[model samples]
Target chain A: MVETFGRHIRQSLGQLSYAAGFQLFLFKETFNFLGKRRIGLRVLILQILFTGVEALSIISLLSLGIGAVIIIQGAQLPDFLLGEQLYRILIIVIARELGPLLTAFVIIARSGSAITTELGNMVVSHEMEAYLSVGIHPVSQLGVPRLIGMSISMFLLTVYSNVFGLLGSLTVSSIITRVRLADHLSALFANFYLVDIVASIAKSFVFGIIIAATSVYYGFSVSGAITEVPVKTIRSIGVSIVLCVIADGIIILLTMLVTA
Target chain B: MIDVPIVLDDVTIRFDGRAALDGLSLEFQRGKSTAVIGSSGSGKSLVLKCAAGLIFPEEGDVLFEGRSIATMGEREYQQMQARTGFHFQDAALWANKSLGENLSLPLLAADPDLSDYALHGKVAESFASVKLELDPSLRPAAISMGQQKMVSFLRATISRPEILFLDDSLSFMDHAGSRQLMARIEEFKDAGATIIIATHNREFSGRLADRVVVLSDGRMVASGPYQEVMSSQDPALLPVLRDLV
Candidate 1:
């Protein structure tokens, strides 16, 4: 029983080491592709369209719903208790926290799974060999564009989600609580500091890199079977979400420490 | 004596504790066609992959033009690859790209300065060689399996690499199509390109290979001229040689 347990632990460690090594190789190849200008602009644009532009409507609707719920809940509390501080709360929650997390959730659901499955299928089909045999590096041709596109898209989406969430909540407040839109806007602008913007962007950017890199890592790790594609896709999503949350916490903490 | 362009020296490959290839040493004569024949699980395809630098052997070296491919830098290895072509058994065409794009990628990678018209012209020439005149915009899914294999052959040879490797590339085609493609492969050999093929098809091997190497249980059983090896009654070769008969 001890031997079996030890074997299992060893296998897990080996798998982890393999994954870390693959990520480093991918990171080096991505930078090499960028430096050499081997980046395929057409592929980059397509990824952006798929990961960012195509996600706008869904993000808009979800952000609007979230914004309204937060405002409604905050208003239900005693005015003497919350008062003008409500906008500050909204800015912190929506802009600094929920915006990046929710945007990454959408991306992990959509683009992350797709990247894993697509690359996994390519491996099973021997299309990866097709790329390698021709002297075209798959990581350079496929991974780099996806990495750059998803990272940029995630950052932009975070900003978009925040704007819609803040605006949607203010619109709801205007109708339900008789709060003027101008007053809400003033409070938001006053409380929304530069650090908040930096923190949100940093979180989204790091989360984007994590998602793209992890998805590609798992995708390339697939071997032999078609059934492995879905398995890797699920793993990519789970791992990417967990990493994004941890990164969010770290970034927020660091930002607070620096500003304090 | 014919000059050798590629040599496998004391190569060994293992998978899951079993040696797929065990200290196998062989040289491929320049501008000559060689066939590696073996039963299933006998490491025929693995030998071809190692020679092509697609898979590295666990022990020993693969030398191309007298230099160890294992020691070559990435740029040098890529340049070496650019001058070589490999056709997979499954054809392995990129599903995401159209047939035209699949054919264009290697050509463009080899020479990025080629004009669009020039690329189209080269692609057209290759399709015409195979008597295939389909729309280039069609994806591999829209094509038949036989056509996909033919496209893969064309994709591999379009750049006219100095060395070509075909891993059972003609297995799926009709006899007539196979004959035509083999004839084209012959034309490639005549142009001074070294050709190596791994196949179970006796007639195909007999027709194309001047030298035949028979493999069994990951070891070299027989090696010589095609007729001599096929005619050998050695006990180690009987099982595989029976297929040729």
Candidate 2:
């Protein structure tokens, strides 16, 4: 029994080596995909449209509602805490933390699963095999477009979410807290550092790559069987979420350390 | 007489300890139809796959015109792929795509330069060949199984392959449909293309093949001109051939 277990373990390790080589092949193919001018541009545009602009709707609405509620709460705050610290609270939540994280979460939910399943099904159906047989690497042809699209989408959405969230908060503060626009702007500029903006941008970018890669990896790793498809999809999503959370935590800790 | 276009030299493929094709050696020649006949578990399909470069053998080699397919570089592989059409057993049509989309897949795979309009025209020609007048936007699930088979055929031939590999691609068709398909295959054959099909239907094989090769337990049991092999067969295949007739 022990010998059998050892033999299986060695066999699995061998398979894992093959899988790793396959992934490297796929990664190189992605580089080729990025080199294509027309198809790459068109795919990028589609991703920005689908992953960025289209995905912004729900996050924007949520930010707006949150901003409104924050303003209303500030208005009712005992006058001491309401005066100078109101805009600070708004900036910290909307610009620094809540906006980027929530936007990333939304992208993972909406676009991540779709990209994974699409690539996964391609692998399951022997399209990947077909591509390989034809000497066109599947990763270069299929995956790079997705990686580029998702990354651009995540970056744009994060920027948009932050900007919109700030706007919503500003409107609420103006209407409910009687805070002057000039005062809010002066206060924001007084404390804002280039590092903070860089950190937020960097966080979103890393999150985008992680989401796209993990999702795609799961999808492309499915063995060709009729019954294995649904199982592959479930594993892909579960893996993507876990990876996203871990990356998010690490990014937060690193950024905090750097900014401090 | 047709010239031999493909040769499998003592090729062996195994999956998990079970041999799919064990030391199988065969040849498929141009301008002739060769039917690979086998029982359900026999690796007739694997031979076509090895020829198509979809599967690699653990032992021996698959040769296309004396050049090893397993060792060809990417450029050579692409050139070979452009020269052959492989019809998957289940059609393997993209369900999310329409009938036109499925048919156009091979064309798109070979040449990304084709415009949508030109692609549509070429797709129309393939569909016309296969007797399908499918809408460009109608998805696969919306089509009948026979129509799906036709769509797969259109996809397979769209690139104008020099060698055609059909793996159980004729099983689902009725007599009329099969006859129509055979006529199309004959047209392809007349164009100087080689055809190899793995099938169980004796009628399909009997009417179609110039020669037939029977595979049992991943080994070539008998092979010759279809009628000659059928008449002078060993007892192993005689009963099966009689049943088929």
Candidate 3:
């Protein structure tokens, strides 16, 4: 029994090591194929369209709603002190934390699963073998464009979340406190810093790459069965979310250190 | 492209912790045709993939042009991939792509500067070789299974590689389609391209192959010229000859 348990642990560790190695391989291959992927720019455009542009309405709605909630709850903070404290809170939440994280969540649910399912099905159908048979590298042909597209889209969408959230906060302050748009703007501008923008961009960009790599890696991991497609897709999304959050935490720590 | 021999030096592969290929060694000579005959799961496709560098063997080397593929430079490897074709057992067309895009991928990879007109002409020529008309704009799902297989063949051979590796070449075809495919393979054969076919079809082996490699249970049980191997009357030959028939 002990020997069987030990063998199982060894096998698990071996698989974990292989999976980590493959992610590095994908990154290296993507770098090598960056110039080559320009010929297929249509794929990158479509990916941005789907992951960024298409998700604009939902992201706007969610950001606006979150912004309104923060304003309403700030009304509870004991008096006229709400205006000063609220704008700072908005900057922290919308720019440094939730803006990037929420945009990544939206992208993960949409593009990450789609990538995994598409690539996994290709592997099952032997389309990957067909691509390889002709001497085309799958990472270059598929992964590079996706990684670039997702990261670019993620960075831009996080900026949108920050902008739209501020707009929503402005509208709420006007309705509830009768504060002028100028006063709200001045307050937000006073609190917002260059570091907040950098942190948001950094977090979203890293999340984009994490999602793309994890999804594509798992998609290619399906071991030749149709049933494995869904399994790998689920695994891709789970790993991508975990990696994104862990990355987000690390970036948050770094930004704090820089500010300190 | 000039032709070169592909030698599998005692190649072995494993799947799910079991040996899929066990020290199987064979050579496909330049400008010659060889057939690998075996039962299903006998590692016929594995041998073709190993030789094509699509699947690396766990042990031993796949040597192309007298050098192990492991030692080849990126440019050298790319040149060979651009010049060698391997038709998979399944049709394996990219379902999302229009048939034109599917055929255009390898052509573009080989020569990115190829003109649009020239690309269409090359694709048309491949279809014309098999005496079929397929609209390039249509996806693979819109085509019949036999037609998909034909397109797969044309896609593989459209680049006109000097070496051809075909796995289950005539699968999912009608009698007429099979005949047309066979004629096309014969054309490649006569053009002096080195051809390696992994098939159970008696006719493909009997008509196209000069040498036969018989595999059973992941090992090479017999190898020789087709006629000599067929007439050997060995027990392994019985199964290969009968099961193939």
Candidate 4:
């Protein structure tokens, strides 16, 4: 029993060390690409289109649905129970929390899985060897562009989700409660804080890095078989979502401390 | 006499408690074609990979042009790699890029100052040599396996690398296609490129290689000219050579 337990601990530590080393290599290559101006603009632009622009319609629709639901449910509560500052609740829930989280989930579902599968297939086919043989750094040619693009996409999508969700909520509130559009807008603007925006953006940015890095790492980790691609993709998504949530909790806690 | 360009000194590689290469040491003569021949699971490909610096050995060193590859810095390693080209056994083309873009990206990586016109001309020249006339916009999936192999060969040699490594790269081709491709390889050889190939095809090796090394169970059993190795009576190599001939 002791031997088995010790072996398990050693295996876990080895995996952690491997992961940390790969992340360091990725960051170093990313900075190397930036310093040398070898940023592969064409790849970066395509990644932005795939991760950001292509995801806009679904994100907008989902945000609108979420916002309408929130408003409809909040309207059922009595004013005496929550006070007159209902928009404060809406802003806190939507902009400061759900916006970044939902946007990250969408990206993880769409681009994260795709990145992992694509890279995993490349590894299985020995295309990574082809890249290395040609003196091209795969991290600079592949990783950096995806990293920067995904980070930028996450930030933009989070902001977009906030805007559409707020607008949808306002439309629903005006229709149901006979509130003026101007009044709803005024309440939202009044309640929203710069700290909230900062926290949301920071969360999205960090989530983007985590998701991209994790996907690429798992993608390259695949060896030998085609069956490993889907397995790695699932692993990439699961790990990315967990990491994003952990990061979100930490950021929120820090933001609350600073604002308090 | 040409200087040796690559040396594997007492190299050993192990995987999952099994040694794939066991204390293998050999020097590849510059400007000559050498063929590594072995049965499946005999570490023929591992030797090529180790010499190319694609796989570091577990126990010894690989030297390219008198400099140890294990000790070379990133810049120096990249510089060394720029002058060497490796054609994978699977003909590993980048799936995301079209065939032309795949060829162009490496050339651009090596010399970023190359103009688009010059790059296009280079790509066209390589395709023309292989008698491959296809839309450059098409991905490898659109092409047949033989065409993909040709594209991989062109990608490896398009920049005219000084050291070329071919890992069973011509196995998919027929006799005519193999001859055409080998003729093109001869052009590279005539231009003084060092060529190392791992192949089971006896006729192919006999046609191209000056020296042939036969391996079995991760150790070199025979090494010399192709005809000499084939004619040798060494007990360990006899069975493998008989099957090849």
TM-score top scorer: 4
Candidate of highest DockQ: 4
Chain A TM-score values, per prediction: 0.94, 0.82, 0.94, 0.95
- State the TM-score for model 3: 0.95
The lowest-lDDT stretch of 10 consecutive residues in candidate 2 chain B is B236-245
DockQ of each: 0.60, 0.35, 0.65, 0.67
Ranking by lDDT: 1, 4, 3, 2
lDDT-wise, the better of 1 and 2 is 1
lDDT per residue (tens digit) for residues A1-260 in model 2: 99999999999999779757866765666667644544346556776788888887798897777766766766665762355566567666677677777887788778877776777777666667655544455666666777878888888888888877777877776666576867766776676677668867887888888777766776677767656666766776677667767876887788789867
Q: Candidate 4, DockQ to 2 decimals?
A: 0.67
Whole-model Cα lDDT per candidate? 0.88, 0.76, 0.86, 0.88
Q: What is the lDDT of residue B150 in candidate 1?
A: 94
Write model 3 residue lDDT over B95-138, tens digit each, in one string.
98888888888998888888999998888877777777778899
Between candidates 1 and 3, the lDDT winner: 1
Question: What does candidate 1's lDDT look like per residue over B122-178, in tens digits?
Answer: 999989988997899999999988899999999999988999999997778987788
Window of ten residues with lowest summed lDDT in model 3 chain B = B1-10
Tally clashing residue pairs in candidate 3. Answer: 0
Residue-pair clashes per prediction, in order, are: 0, 2, 0, 0
